[model samples]
Target: LACAFMVMSGYCELTSVSSFDAGSFSSKIVTLESIQIFTTHEWLPAKPTLYFLCQGGNRTGLPDVKKVDFLYTFNGDESWQPLTELPERKCKRCGLYEEDQIKSDDVFDEWELCPGDFVDGKYVHFKEKEFNATFACPLCKPLEEGSPSSASKNEATAHGMNVALVIVISALVSIVVISGAAVGYKYWQKKKREQEQARFLKLFEDGDDIEDELSLGNTL
Candidate 1:
């Protein structure tokens, strides 16, 4: 299996802005512009075949590097070669590695490749003991500003949603309060009616006892 370690240092700057697909803002092409190897990591004197590897097991082989400490530039022919497509919001694990015949491939360096890391559509990654490389993507750009009307529309929509949620919550609370008040009033009325009935029954019982006493006194 191929492997790589992370150690990066480079300078990147944006020089121009280019239009990209509206449907796929995150997707942008990555191309290799140049690379200079510091150490080939070989035991014998031999040319090293290098390749780029990224997430999802994507690989692209580069031209064989003939010498160390020498800068190799790619012409327009290789400029069109797509190394990978990177997303603006997410980073992909990518690296350079040497192809090996007897064992697993040796890693030069690996790092999280992110479109956001590019300044002015270009990024340079350098590992002190391994290699220094430059990658370019003409279409990669910073977040573009939308029209004022669009921003206003989005804000208005969000405000309207908040208002609707408040209205719904208020309506529910009012309904619960009204229902509770109605139940309390009904309970009060029932209690009052029961008290009135109890008072009337007591008066009737007292009248019957008084009549019985008067009848008994008259008999005596």
Candidate 2:
């Protein structure tokens, strides 16, 4: 018995506008830029628990801002977490903040995401004065040395595999088609031979009957 495997696909995405220069307050604000969406299928056999690991930063190394706040929203859920865990290591100089100055404490304490706020579907949207972003787990790919780069490579590899799979599928289909044509040709040849044999037998019987008729007439 052959055991079949089902393809259970899933993915997460992150979107942000171009990086903002938060200056010395870089750690205080994530350069708000673009928003992203995440989607995935939930298999019946194994349901996975989802977790969010979020991060932010400023591109400039200038003196960080005095204080910054961060806001977040999630799909189908009202109100966002004031503060979420950073995706990367914490900077020793900034304490709770990641390098570039986006501090975890300021966001949770100062940010306000009152009513009628939602991130929209399997995604966590981070919004701030200078920083706006969104994240999801399943759709998140890994970066070359980190989650971001690895994620991109994974997508490229998956695409290549899909292309190879299509080629293999086409080859198998061609083989099946060729085999069917050969079988049909053999069947046609067998039927033609049978018809020829029948025709020859009918002619032989007619000739015998004619000879019998001649003999009878002569005797008469």
Scored by TM-score, the top model is 1
- lDDT of candidate 1 over 1-220, digit per residue (tens): 1222222111111212223344444458788888899988667677888889997967898874668899988752573367888765566899999987778999999898866557788889999889999888776754434745345546878999999999999999999999999999999999999999999999999999999999999999
RMSD score of candidate 2 (Å): 22.9
- Kindly report which residue pairs in candidate 1 clash with one another: 14-119, 14-120
Q: How accurate is candidate 1 locally (lDDT)?
A: 0.78
lDDT value, residue 218 of candidate 2: 100
- Candidate 2: where is the Cα deviation over 4 Å? 1-146
Q: Write the per-residue lDDT of candidate 2 for residues 45-107, one digit (tens) a residue.
A: 332222222334222211222223323333412233222322232211111212312232222
Model 2 poorest ten-residue lDDT run: 7-16
List per-prediction Cα lDDT, in the order shown: 0.78, 0.39
Q: Report the Cα lDDT for candidate 2.
A: 0.39
